[model samples]
Target: MQSIEKYPHYFNSIKEVHENIQSIIPEIAGAYKNKYNLSFPVDINLIVGGFGSNAYTYRQIIPNITFALEKLSPNPDHLRVIVAHEFGHLAQYIMLDDAGMDWSKSRWTHPLIWLYREGIATHLSRQIADNIHPSVYFSYNDEGVQWLTFAQANMIRIKQAFMEDFKALTSEKLFHEWFSINGGNRFGYSRLAYFLGNRFVLEYMEKHGEQATIIAWREENFEAKIAQWLSQEGVDKSE
Candidate 1:
């Protein structure tokens, strides 16, 4: 574990946020494990930016660790939800490589990674709340909703592409270029992927059973995986 100095004397509120986050970790992890059958005491990947900024990350590294995390919240209830959303990231990251596309430096690399990453993380942040809890959001930005909607529309298409009808994107340069060109829309791409990916996963489980979905999530043919998604949805490729 590494320790970074706190943002010295910024908004001072950052410390409170930090303390709040640490306090809630254990309870959050417990809920995730119980609900999802995930491993407990999960690793946390937290990045707190100077006033008015935050980012979350998780790795697809092996040995399967899903740190069920809720995000930063001053309120106790919101904090727990944030932690769970982060846990969602951990779950997605563990399954990333199995989807078979390498991570691209491009902002656009998100789609290649797997449908779970972008949408779920944001979904956790924005949606995924108990009836009593406050919703998470991207700085109360309406554009955020638009981006999410965009992703939701295209998700089915992207997942199908992941399963099939896809080219192995090996060019790092191309990846970076496309990502840079797309910029924030890359986020939208991720959202779209998640929207579709989770549905596919849900249906897959219903049809194949939990164990099969977990195993096939790791080994199914990329094209075959996509066929089901693409058949049902037409992506709004505008942008």
Candidate 2:
């Protein structure tokens, strides 16, 4: 795997943050490979910008993993969580490819599908970081901890709220409602899907085991399996 670093002037001004990322790259990559079983070479790029701290994987001639280092906590542990989460996406893509599935064909517009993808990544991130230490896994940042706490505390309510709207909504409508800032906030929580998805993954892992969960995710009938699991748990999706 190859790595590239690009720091904005402001980012370069912070010696610790820059140095922390440099120090953490190998650890992140090592954890990713050992945990996720991903062996393909990926181009990992770190960029400093104001667009918000997020990571994306671009599959072109090679898999390009890019992380935007804006609005991120300077804490190295926090950065590790972000890196692990992003690497989860890369792992997902590789798994899909191995399963003879095209990542481009993923139904991003579907809220459930989007939730599963993000949730799995979040779950993997937590697992990867926890392998180092429990504190690093759980207390990466205040907002993340708060959001996760809120999500867990209100999981049933969130599921009920989602079920109430899932039937009548189209994929596009569902995506907008569940993922968009204004739409997400309408249900008294924003980005609820991330938490919900994480819960879903956790449930699956609890029942099926981690490697099985990953395999299930790669299968074409993954959503159907999720729906069945939800039904078994009495999560009503019918109108």
Candidate 3:
């Protein structure tokens, strides 16, 4: 309420966002369907104010994507990447559910789980969206200039700190420092974990192949494998 009141222009593009987002949803979803040969019903909902994310996926008997128009970038390329990223999440969840993944037992609280989730989605966004500037795939907008530069330069340091946090920090602290928008105490940039996740997906795909890496969530030793990957040195150099 306060944000809307003070920064009315923040949501001034709501109408435009609504039109463009509705127009692109099917196109991007179709590309994903064709790429993976997996088609599933998805409900795309647009809202004025959401949980502060530009977009996210939620499943309640069916998969749905919610776009907070105010948080979104109206640039067509950014919209495609963001939408495709959310659908990438849908593809991941559907694959796991089809494999009989017990949602109750899944390690939802683990940071590495999130790393894989965001990593694969970011990877899929890069593939699904038409050729755009590379940083758009990660940050989904032009505003990511600083974030991209920092992530590229400090990849190894970030991984080391992330691994240390995995062993030392609680889930809440880990997420805040790495994943949340308000994070970045160490590196002065939030959501650096997305960069980490992308690297994980890339390396894992190189080692195990794309199909296996996509469904690695179902593997019995997922945690151990991710831990081992994290413990290794110079994984950044591979990229």
- Residues 120-159 of candidate 1 have per-residue lDDT tens digits of 4434333333443221332221234565455556555454
TM-score of 3: 0.92
Per-candidate count of clashing residue pairs (backbone under 3 Å): 17, 0, 0
Candidate 3, pairs of clashing residues: none
Writing each residue's lDDT as its tens digit, candidate 2 over 1-239 gives: 11224345346534565678777777877887786667658777777554543556674423678766654556777878877877776677677677666656555445567778777778778877764433333334545555555666666777776766677778767766775544565456566766667778877788888766664655666677655544444442210
lDDT of 3: 0.82
Check candidate 2 and list the clashing pairs. Answer: none
In TM-score terms, candidate 1 sits at 0.52
- TM-score, each model? 0.52, 0.75, 0.92
Residue 223 error, candidate 2, Å:
1.8
Candidate number achieving the greatest lDDT relative to the actual structure: 3
- What C-alpha lDDT do the candidate models reach, one value each? 0.44, 0.64, 0.82
In model 2, which runs have C-alpha deviations exceeding 4 angstroms?
1-15, 59-62, 102-108, 131-140, 169-173, 180-183, 228-239
The candidate with the higher lDDT, 2 or 3, is: 3
Residue ranges of candidate 1 with Cα displaced over 4 Å? 1-13, 45-78, 89-113, 116-182, 185-191, 209-211, 234-239
